[model samples]
Target: MALYGITEREKAVTVTHAGVPHPDAECHGVVAQATQNRVLVVFVSALQRVAHPPAFADTDAEVGKH
Candidate 1:
């Protein structure tokens, strides 16, 4: 919770199990509260964009119209 900058957890919980979020944890009990590091960890679910790989989807165009 370093102002949303410093956090890399893999279950070695510490910092008194972090804090500041417990609104009835849900997502797997909020990742089990980060093994007690409370929360602020988002393993995934945040990529509104940036998934390139369709520069033409199997290209075959050269300014045509059937």
Candidate 2:
């Protein structure tokens, strides 16, 4: 993915269990298929959660603020 600066081809595979995304797998596809800005946005958003802890009591008003 663009976030990783690498190219990868999608492969078909059968899965028996629930498939989960990896923390480091920021982008789903190859870098060539993504824009630098899009990658940066996702990266920044992930970092924001780390830098700022979420409110314990989240409400509809809080969600609307963003």
Candidate 3:
């Protein structure tokens, strides 16, 4: 996961990557951030859903454990 962009209020962030979309296509992986320089990352299959800010610690903990 990588930092793609930041939100308008600067309270959120966006991370993006290449991933599978739906059952058939590749899509832009978008993750929301609201933390530090690394922020947070999430792979969103649906671009529309990325409009919200994603939790960072939860994502970090989940990925970090793995």
Best-performing candidate as measured by lDDT: 2
With candidate 1 superimposed using the best TM-score fit, by how many Å does residue 60's alpha carbon deviate from the native? 40
lDDT of 1 by residue, 1-66 (tens): 521222333233322333212111233334545566433343221211232222223333332223
Q: Deviation in angstroms for 4 in model 1?
A: 30
Candidate 2 Cα errors over 4 Å, as ranges: 1-36, 53-66
- In terms of lDDT, the poorest run of 10 residues in model 3 is 17-26
lDDT of 2 by residue, 1-66 (tens): 244342231122112212212222334323323555776666666664564322232435454356
Query: Which pairs, if any, clash in model 3?
Result: none
**Which predicted model would earn the best TM-score?**
2
Alpha-carbon RMSD, candidate 1: 17.9
| Model 3 lDDT per residue over 1-66, tens place | 233222232223213211112211111333333332232333333433554333222343355347
Which pairs clash inside model 1? Answer: none
lDDT of each: 0.31, 0.37, 0.30
Could you give the candidate ranking by TM-score, starting with the highest? 2, 1, 3
What is candidate 1's CA lDDT for residue 43? 29
